[model samples]
Target chain A: MIEDKNQQRTNLSELGEFGLIKHLTKNFEINQPSTFKGIGDDAAVLDFKDKKAVISTDLLIEGVHFDLAYMPLKHLGYKSVVVNLSDIYAMNAKPTQITVSVAVSNRFPLEALEELFDGITLAAKEYTIDVIGGDTTSSQKGLIISITAIGEAEESELVYRNGAKSNDLLVVTGDIGSAYMGLQVLEREKQVFQVNPNNQPDLDAYTYIIERQLKPEARKDIRTLLHALEVKPTSMIDISDGLSSEIIHICKQSEVGCNLYEDKLPLDPQLINVCEEFNIDSTTVAINGGEDYELLFTISMDDYDKIKGNPNFTVIGHMTPESEGIHLVTRANTKIPLKARGWNALNG
Target chain B: MIEDKNQQRTNLSELGEFGLIKHLTKNFEINQPSTFKGIGDDAAVLDFKDKKAVISTDLLIEGVHFDLAYMPLKHLGYKSVVVNLSDIYAMNAKPTQITVSVAVSNRFPLEALEELFDGITLAAKEYTIDVIGGDTTSSQKGLIISITAIGEAEESELVYRNGAKSNDLLVVTGDIGSAYMGLQVLEREKQVFQVNPNNQPDLDAYTYIIERQLKPEARKDIRTLLHALEVKPTSMIDISDGLSSEIIHICKQSEVGCNLYEDKLPLDPQLINVCEEFNIDSTTVAINGGEDYELLFTISMDDYDKIKGNPNFTVIGHMTPESEGIHLVTRANTKIPLKARGWNALNG
Candidate 1:
């Protein structure tokens, strides 16, 4: 990454903190009337009118959360912003603005920072969210990205994880395990590259899974389509910790149990092939592999008729009384008690 | 730290994401009515009756912001929360709530986390701000702390850095340079201890300065006292970036000039004594030393009479015409142009 040298560059100290802020944010027009004031005071002022606000925050570290070798700065920056937006979408709200703060070490050149900001600016444009305000400082080790996204929605349309009741149908958006399989594929190729840097990564066939991990999209459209169809989920949570883990969260919070069918667990063909090649059970991967970025929700049984056959969603299970406990029906007709073994299995 | 037998014994995977949140926040109580929902939903919900709300955030890294070797987890936790609250005070608003999210490695024992939360709980009690919501995940490396503080104030009551006018007097709360001296002392002692662990550090004389570094207080009282005395700052910013940089910020933002007097610079006696011992200039430390966490502001000439001899403040300078630029009248009876070395000066 080469620094931009054509324009006259001013040292940050030349303008001081306040001047630097004003200079950098000069062109940042506040399109949202909700932004009462931005970047002139100790904090930005927000006005949401009568609508309630949905707030979510996420932290992404350089070495821990991502690797600069394979992960492009643009993609890393884009993913960091999208991750927080997914949380807002999960709440069924329209993300309007965000505050992005970065802590970086001197090891990164100024050109590297520009690349990072390029991705951030691109994502901000795509999301139609104004970059309101944030603090930037130096870190001791790697770069740290912390984002706080603010969204808005009517009080009645909001969703919570504790709203599920007995007999509600569980549904999942898109497919599961692709992102996890993608991660595996990347790691294997990385090892291959480490052993021989000249080895070309055979990523053409693994495009679908790799894209899942590198650029997973938020289910913001799912919320819009459901609203258009007049179907509200009884309870919903994003599939970040895998389907089994998220399902357990809904069940525990809603005071209900569930029985998911192993045959109905959705999987991409490429992902299944990759899992098979790795000698891991495809079912285990679907149930436990994380970072899917899909939506897992529970809808009332009466409303299930609206989209039971919809190509975009899959009906996997139904909630039962809490005392019954959660279970999984296998293809062999044997029932297994569902315990949250997603991440714990990997750790042990 | 030692590991806690009871709490430390449970694995994070056992609780998963949702369960971990519920288990950790079980002891936390919601004291602010504006905090409609917290922790369980995809996003936290905030409902405020006021027309506008103030939001601010900060990130504290492991080594750059703090040293784990000497700084205890409890103080780190306290300092993180206070830093956000200080920003709210700078806006002349009372902090009502905060969302704290942290990521740390498994190297930390359960007792260490408890000690960290112990300080958070204590700060909540002292500041009367609710710990509303947060996200927690396993970090790959060191500890990372991100806090977003929300406060309420009328549009007219809020202060802006652009509000300063010519002839306004620049004032700072408490003293400066002590925190910088404290850091030097701690660093020196750390080097000594590293050479011989068995040797005891005779630090009784440097106790005050060390505490100033380890546990700096935000100028929360200054805002309240200013309100009580019926004096409002024309423009304000917290002094986390040293006095020289802060003065430059006010001048640049307000489009005015300033003239500071070297004799008027405030310094704790211990800071002066230690600076002398270290063969360092106390004025340099006062001008460029950071992490003071004090309030720096300008007041109009009309209100100057009310705050002239106040023990809690020092009028270090006065605003001048924009063409005059910022100047420092040296003790040698010469006017010298002021330069803000800022945080970037560390490289020199």
Candidate 2:
């Protein structure tokens, strides 16, 4: 549906498997000292020395996780890397290497894969991580991308989801719900395009929301920022599955209930406007929308003074005893029980 | 086509994504010292300490890599992890942890996934590795599995493909070609079964070959054996893409040539019988067949005496200067150039 007309198409058979891998990764630069060896061997060798290694993996399937109609190949590749790296950042670690495995059907031309790799290379460079190793092969149907990100952190610096305690302050980085709104806008435009392919979408007002959806950057600078502020999170998790779900995860693992303040929930101005345009509730979107890629974490109440007015962070709420149950305090001073309305890929 | 007639089926959406992951990996035991924290977090934390880390990843898509008509879910899961771990063993590292990501269509019931994870758990127990993390999601088509294996070894003990030198003796552990023949037997059976569903063809004679194809094991004991013999390989690689392709890889990377002895190519007795029955060349299958999961490496001449006469290994060739091209020295006193007929996943 999104095929580019006038573009050069090269059959994947022209390069074969090994030839394609070599051609795609030939320009990948290895700048990480931790990477003792990169691609070209059976496995990539890494030297973490005294530091701890943090590993995370994610799988992205076409039609299930993304639609090619609105999601460009390059954007899809970039998002894949960023999402995996977000998990590392959630652990307060510095991502050092990534292994990307892609399985594409014959329907995708060589140029399409080149575009995907170009995005991967760009993200690796931008994140200052080495593209260590990967596998590329054919699929029977649509494209599939699996990325494993490796990061390094000192043993003492790492955070886990079970460290939060009752009364800890809940803090989130940046805004939420923008990516979900961006997806909504894109979906609407896709339907409009289906009706009239000649119609050009003038999406100037949706610039921020669309960028949030298409090119959402991980909170790479938050680790340094938190360190500079002398604040270590008691527990942390990335907001990939919406605020309500992540809050539930932290609560369940940390054995604490939370009072998430609806008034304090960070929502992008663009997201608010888009929700109004779509006649959706901004608070519901902020709490239940997914793919914000923001950092939702808990810090000791003692550190709240240090981050009181920081623009990068929003003091969302505070943890409570498990018996209190998880709730969102609305602006009307009424508390409502929160439910995990996150995107469930398996439900699709 | 291979579905059980009376197997219990449970929808996956009933458990949701988080509950399904929790259920599938609840039985995984963490026994590795390197694994500090496993699942229940955004990323797994590993303490590699002073050891170097080896990482490798592979993606297996249904139909492209295996046919479910003959491949069981459990065996498929086991083979997927084994294949990836084989890459780590090829680097002379002991695999410690792995992250598995799977995407399956709604057609796959919860019972099928349980069977698949059961095999993953079994392989982890057999290999003594930790199933640290993974992702489970739905696909639009068939099943897709991506696994990244992490191993560790001392810097001095690690091996790479570029360490081979001229005059080094090439050796291979165990036998080759049986796995390819096993696949042939299974394919033929599948075809026959299609013609008559109730036909029960005897497969006793093809037991070993079928087992090799369906439930192959990686050479995890080779490293210990080589260490006990006090012989460090100059260069090493796993035979995942047939003998000739791996030889070419080592030769090209190490800047050396090889003279492989056709008569010395290791072949199982069952493979010979099967080749005779199928009217195929045993030598060709030995050199060109894939998925043997055996170790192919070169050791310096000084270590040859230490490894010679070992029943687990066979000296198949010797490295030569780059000026001499790679060739096969036949027992009939004829030198024929070697060609790589490795399975190309992208070709299909």
lDDT of 2: 0.92
Highest lDDT: which candidate? 2
After superposition, candidate 2 runs with Cα above 4 Å error:
A1-6, A342-348, B1-6, B342-348
TM-scores for all candidates: the values are 0.91, 0.97
Residue A101 alpha-carbon offset, candidate 2, angstroms: 0.2
lDDT tens string, model 1, A122-237?
77787777788887777767788899988888889888899999999999999999988888788788778789877877688789998888777777789888998789988888
Clash pairs, candidate 2, are none
User: What tens digits encode model 2's per-residue C-alpha lDDT throughout B1-348?
Assistant: 354542788999999898899999998999999999999898999998999999999999999898888888889889999999999999999999999999999999999999899899999999999999989999989999999999999998899999999999999999999999999988888888999988887988989988999999999999999899998999999998899989999999999999999999988899999999988888888888999999999999999789879999999999999989888899897888876763442123
Q: Model 2, A1-348: lDDT tens per residue?
A: 343552789999999799999999987999999999999999999999999999999999999898989888888889999999999999999999999999999989899999899899999989999999999999988999999999999999999898999999999999999999999999999999999998889999999999999999999999999999999999999999899999999999999999999899888888888989998888888888899999999999999999999999999999999999999999999998888973442123
Which segments of candidate 1 are over 4 A away from where they belong?
A1-29, A341-348, B1-26, B342-348
| Residue A332 Cα positional deviation in candidate 2, in Å, after optimal superposition | 0.9
